[model samples]
Target: MTTTTATYDPGLIDMTNEANKKIKVLLELRPALDGFAGIPQEVRLLFRGLRKIESVDIEGLLQTSHRRLARGTSDTGFFRKKISAARRYNRISNVIISMAEKPYRNVLDIIMDYFQKRAEVASLQISMVSGFGKIKLTRFESKSFEDFTWRTIFSKTLPASDFSLVAPANHRVCSVPWHTLHTVGLSTLNWRSTPKYPKLDTKGFDIFIGQTPYPARVDPDTAYVIRYHDAIPIFMPHTISDKSLHQATHFYAMMSNVKSGAWFACVSEATRQDLIRIFPEVTDRAVTIHNMVAHHYFLENSAFERVPGIIRSRLYEGDPSKGIELLPKFFSLREKENFYKRSLGDKHFKYLLIVSTIEPRKNHTRLLAAWEVLKADVDPDLKLVVVGTLGWEHSSITKAFSSWIDRGDLFMLNAVPAPDLRVLYRHAAATVCPSLGEGFDFSGVESMASGGITIASDIPVHREVYEDAAEYFDPYATMSLVKALKKVLYEEGAQQEQEQMRQRGGEVSSRYLPEQIIPQWERFAERVVAERKSIKSSTTTVFEEKNSSVSST
Candidate 1:
């Protein structure tokens, strides 16, 4: 086998093209390979890789085995043959291999070094301002973000966390040692003056992460990383308002600045892609890092079996044999009758659980309608348990829910304990989420984690996370949702499908575990810091050069 060294032409591929832009950036940042050099080892490896391509006959190379070479999987024989062929064509082998052994050292170094640097950083400060305390930044404050300084503020309008504080806490708030906390309930302040107005000093912090990009308190110079949870405004156009429009524009602007400055992290790739589609300019800087669940939340088999007596008692209070009417003040006569029948036997009623606030975005009304359609065909013993507090300006939903309450098929638990919710997920025949939109459907994932088959909306984000594991249905299609629900409840292979979903859920759950996701967070923070430093260095160099030139003149 003769050696065929092909003359490599870098120009054959326009590095500036959108397809190769990311690679181009990587190559541009490539470091020189010198152990005694001032540049980082990682950068050195990157430079070595880029130096290998010399010159080439673009068209001729393409006509030969260029495609395979482009793929970076060409065999030694193929490489040798190319070299020999190039020699025959009177083409000089311009490709250099002086530092080929250290080809990818710099790129890997950049990534690893960033992670290492993030771990070294003294502390992180995050500010969470959202309608609901659902994202409860404080929850993670004890674990993943525990080492970081945290500040949280919530809208007083939203509902509070269901459970009370646990006693003898293993984790203390003061673990962070340095934190400036505030609760600006429902107060909307000017974005520009927020830092000074709130007396944050603003200079001490490394990064500011928040739900709203245009927080009244974020300093311009601070690294602002915004959370893009859901496209609720887009998915439900009616939800859009002037305030929302301002928030969206500010979010886009903040994203652009962050991308140019440090880096921006998104909860999911689907969300990151959506953000890119809406604001194409920030595509280069956006990264996906999954949200995490606390370890203590994972209930054991015994814990699952040990349903709180309070929950079981509340669920089954009346004696069916004695014809006793035991009812809560919230239940109507029809609901009371249904509860009476469901409580008749010693055996508990299996439920098809749907847990989400009864908001339009959640599409609860449609789910209820779908459930009604399936009720006639399915077993009467199995109930549709809709658990959540009433939410927002949904009068029609409230009225419909009242009507459902009159019927015997639906059971509504206004609020339940988290452990009880977990039991619901574990025991339910299937958990259905017929939402029109979701940033990250916590309920759906929770159900999956608890070994329940999830029937979710067929949306891009859902598909990205669940992949082929979930039984997807179009939210707009009532028949599709009804069919899926029916299949989950009554199909012949339903048990096997549920088991498969349970396994998939377990696999997917790993990504959300604190142990798995915290390291990724650390890596992301490090990259942002390094990238910011690089940008600052370039700016300083330009400024110094201009100053020197002026002095010389």
Candidate 2:
């Protein structure tokens, strides 16, 4: 195999006389507030890598999707304790919305809604503060960061590093929430008879990077860059939650960004092509920069004995306090004890593992069907283990698991930290990735990084990202998956096949490690800044020529 390196000229422009030579970047941190889910996890990884680049000055935009930020840069204690004022403001806003929804004079409702839009617009105009509600610009408490690091740091394959970097530092927040900006932008279409995107105050930053298609436009001097993940909402709408709203928000915001000439950094080549398919003109502005897998997953000599305890502790048994209950026929107290005890020592206990949200697009139902056949015919001792949070439209999928869950042939665990997840990946018979659609599925690569074999759906992204490292099966065909699993799990020469796949996976997964991916980003940042400078210089030269001609006339 041959590797090609793209030549990058870093000295595209002289910066010796520039007051600020470092490119100042403000990255939206809304995704970081969410749990260790897909986009959120990527945000953490991106921040970690960006901090290591010396030429870039990165700061986080400490704002929430729907919650208003309190004013001032002061002490924001742990647990976001300073959000009390923001909470009170939200209560008032909710009251206004509820009143508008009431049976009043149709005229009164219209008038109230109008006033609400005006207020929201006014709130968005608040000057940018270094922090939200007394939180210092460089130091504040983020429970989300705390939770993420706690789960992944100890579980990392490499020595735990960047502990302090994960905390809140060099961040700024706005008084108005991002949700309000979206609402206001949409409202302007009706209120003024023309759509108007809300403008954000990004005065000091050279570039402002958003996690997705942002609802607001940044200052003219600041270049807006969208870290485009995928077009899933547009292409696979039915599989996602809030189908209508999600599609509308994504489409409208995307259109606005395109019209404003924002740069797009796509997560995969497949995703970049999807974007081009919708808007052909954005081809010049969009580029693919694949996602980086965290350093938490790697080859480990973990014993199979640890699997049972991980399953027992992390299994998502419905909460009794919340009036939610698991199946009445689920493992009995004595039966569970024996099952755990037996599995703790049973070297023959083999389970197929999949880590993805239990959503329709993940193709969990199809995987379940294949697992059932594998268990019934090929290997009766085979078990299926699912590790992911329950997503919307998942009732049927969960229903399919009931019988298997009751019989102790299947297990479901949620919030298993990186440490336990690495162990699960290393010891699984094979990690299955049967997503019907994806921009870049992280699980298969993470499994490979952990010295595990992969069985993936033969989708374009999977083929491009996983290459020949995984056994490909048609996502729509249960029998196809069954055959693929059989060849890897129980067929003749299976051990040799698995070993070969693991070796290939190590090479493939290395392409996404931080060291390999960060250089791409650094070059991209430099090029964007250099291009902007070139454009500015050309414009200045044209203006000077026009002035000289006017003086001669």
Candidate 3:
């Protein structure tokens, strides 16, 4: 007998078992192309965390949701030609669709609409399967891709000072836009009981993980996983930007993913419960593995003097003259100068912070109302700082903010990098998360991680994620938030309670670090692979037994 000992590599997981091959994962990279926050931030963090696990070899699948990628194109000419062609086709299709929808549509118009629908199906098929088997994959060493990689990976955190280059080794582009494939699949939903999903040629990949519910199907041999965020568009349609299309896309894609045996890795228990509420059968397949907080947000000592500079430097540029009419009657240059001077050195210079987009669902107006009351009664020196880019339906919020902004009492900042945001978090009187809904609100945990106090809406996710680390208030009631703010930020004899919350926060936030979360992902992947193997083994055994019985007969 010969004995063989397998030496393990310390960097990766020990693979001494029968199946020694590394699990290959193709992670969708579409979300990372957007702004450096929300889903994009989570996608980037997942990529970075997955890279550190030795048991898995992961590559990025580059496919835009709304933009078509050209096939067999050089790096320089990837989407330009396809986009122009798509736009031209869209114009013609729109004309036909408009004619068909009109009350006085003629036979000619009806014929054209039928042909147009046929042409769309044909185009969708071509886009989906064209050159799928031998599709050429581009590497990620290109300057543009490298820049994109770094921006995505380090968006929510400060990169190491000594860090130079970091990117995935392999990346493949899919010619069909995700939306096209999704919509084509959705065309079947009206007639079929179970909507037929468009198929993706997932040839060699062992696993395909999408950031949301994908509208395409993978091979039965491959496991498809969704990093499910939330079903906001389904439940709270009024809050989202595009009610009809967004809700349909999310609900239909989710239905397809569910029917196709796709596993879900939700960011919170609350999110997982939402999934189960829709499809009870998928309860076994869905699991909760919380999001990873950036490594940049540990407790740090920083001066309050830096806040003004950070805000000014990152201020979201708006039409300075458009809101001039809304400027206060008492607005004066002296007070503005005095505000800056006091922010630089005054001991009483404190600001209330809200880090979210200027959107209705974020409940910015409610927070603003509460802040106004606090300013008038609690502390006149208290300023309000809002940090986020402009989201849809923000005209009213911006309008409400115009007078305060002109008076230098309100600041709107955007594109703040993680290091600067960390400083802001640490020095602020309190960071407020006043969202109407969320999968796992990042701001509150992030504030806690940065040694800052948090006041969040009294939502289920907040209770689950923030726990003892945050003060809670009713999202709908302005007075409730005002009362919570007083207790957390300004009430007498609350310093001891605040200090206790900070201590609890440090411990709570540590649960979301990469080192802690990555193991959960690894274990989930292993379990999925093990189940696949068990199914395969059972199928083979049944097939062999049937063959034996047939031969005897």
TM-score of each model, in listed order: 0.58, 0.83, 0.82
Query: Best candidate, lDDT-wise?
Result: 2
Residue lDDT tens for model 1, 1-553: 1111111123322222123211111111111211211122222221222222221100000001111001111123323443344332221111111112222335854585466334322122223223212111111112222111111111111113301111111111111111121212112233422221121222323444444232223333445455445445544556434446435444443443443343445666766766667667766666666544433234346333343242434342223375522234445778655564554332455667887766677888788777777766676555577776555655577567555554544566644545566677777777888877766666777677766678998987777767666888989999999888777667898777777878888777666765565445444444454455566689899999999999999
Rank ordering of all candidates by lDDT, starting from the highest: 2, 3, 1
TM-score order, best first, reads 2, 3, 1
lDDT for model 3: 0.74
Which candidate wins on TM-score?
2
Report backbone clashes per prediction.
Answer: 19, 3, 0
Q: Report the poorest 10 consecutive residues by lDDT, candidate 2.
A: 127-136
Regarding TM-score, does 1 or 3 come out ahead? 3
Per-residue lDDT of 291 in model 1: 48
Point out the worst 10-residue segment of candidate 3 by lDDT.
Answer: 1-10
